[model samples]
Target: MSKKTEFQALDLISAYSEKKKNPSHLELNQIFPNPTQPRLIGREDTADLVPSMERLGLIEPILVRKDKGKYLIVAGERRYRAAIKLGWKEIPAIVTDANEDVCYEMSLAENEKRKNLNPWEVGKAIQYLRKEKRKTAEEVSELLGYSGRYVKQLSSIARLDQKSVMELMISGKPLSVKNLEELLKRKENRGGETISPRPGSGSGRISINLSKLNGRVRDNFLKELGLLKKKYGINE
Candidate 1:
């Protein structure tokens, strides 16, 4: 997230959405945040933006997409949060009808420009696009206009477990993609560690026949399955 990359999010957004940005002062209630966007760490997070906003009065408009009756933030969650902290009922925005891919593209591009986004956030965002939006690595690469090697590095970041990555983040040690990649690989990144591969990446799966088991065994299996689902927050 340092130094401006060649990625042009707005251009791609215009291409995919084919809709002009409708600038408006939207009520905070009318807008929602992007789930895949990085989380803000409280006053400290908005501390920087708040002062600027107070002085400049929102020089830039946040990007958003209409969903249901509300607007979902496609980019600029940091600014949106700062406005909320300032008790702003209305903030400027550019609302669009962009699909998920376009929204994601803008998000990544904005992150590249801002340079505040961390490696963990980038990993999770990529993982979200892969799982929730069903985007392939190649498609993601093309969307960001990034090279395959760079996208592959990011996909590798997605492989490390959350706890471990968080620990490294807490250490506040600067980590290069290559260094983190190798460190995490010492455990899981040899291939796919915690991350599930792209849907078509492989045919690996597991199946069991509960009917073949006696009642007691089936009951025990189901109990374990229930526990697993709870641990992983899987919906029944």
Candidate 2:
């Protein structure tokens, strides 16, 4: 929920908007996960979701694609996992004929909507699209609702390694995007003697993500925090 970059969202995979098909009860054994799932970079804990599912029973159906007589999860792997853990033999799903590319986009969009994806994980995915020229700068800008320059700036972070991404994921922490970007910039321009955004580094700064909050709520929260910071003589 890192505030959606403000894209006019389209149902790329039609998972949410597909009106032609009703949810089908698919056997848990039949669905396999998409191997290239971007989530593989920083798999999240679906433990919290499990209890909710157990109590309420899946509130939303998962999205899946049928391929080669097997169902591949386009998104909602977390829901599927919870269902598995609950010992359910079958789960409800909306089956779509999304191909590999559409599946990837839908997975990214769904995870993003959940606000669970690490910023770096998103950067890597953007970089992958750019490197392959599958998406141009304009297309990316339109898709993300970010300016071309900003998208390029964000994508530059993909140069960072998976270790850092994993560390953030493990700690459930968000780092200052600007700080990380500046560090990367310096690394490229000035073969920095020591480049680290982890605690040991002097430049390290933690960030609070407000994307999941409603816009007005996040604004009010930030305003209150600013007042508190001023009252406490806190420095940026």
- Separately for all candidates shown, the number of backbone clashes (residues 3 or more apart, or on different chains) is 1, 1
For model 2, give the RMSD to the true fold: 13.7
RMSD of each: 12.1, 13.7
Q: Which regions of candidate 1 fall more than 4 Å away from where they truly are?
A: 1-4, 8-10, 13-22, 38-44, 189-236
How much lDDT does each candidate structure score? 0.70, 0.70
What's model 2's lDDT at 216? Answer: 95
Per-residue lDDT of candidate 1, residues 1-236 (tens digit): 32226564557644534233447889999998876554332313787899999988887788888888899898778899899999999988888677866777787776666665566556666777788889898776666666765666677776777677666767886555655675577775364233322345344554667789999999998998888667545564
The best candidate in terms of TM-score: 2
Q: For residues 145-187, could you state the per-residue lDDT of candidate 2 as single tens digits? A: 6666566656877787776555654676555465556556665
Give model 2's clash tally. Answer: 1
Estimate the TM-score of every prediction: 0.67, 0.69
Task: Give residue 97's lDDT in candidate 1 (0 to 100).
Answer: 71
lDDT of 1 at 124: 65
How well does candidate 1 score on lDDT at residue 223? 97
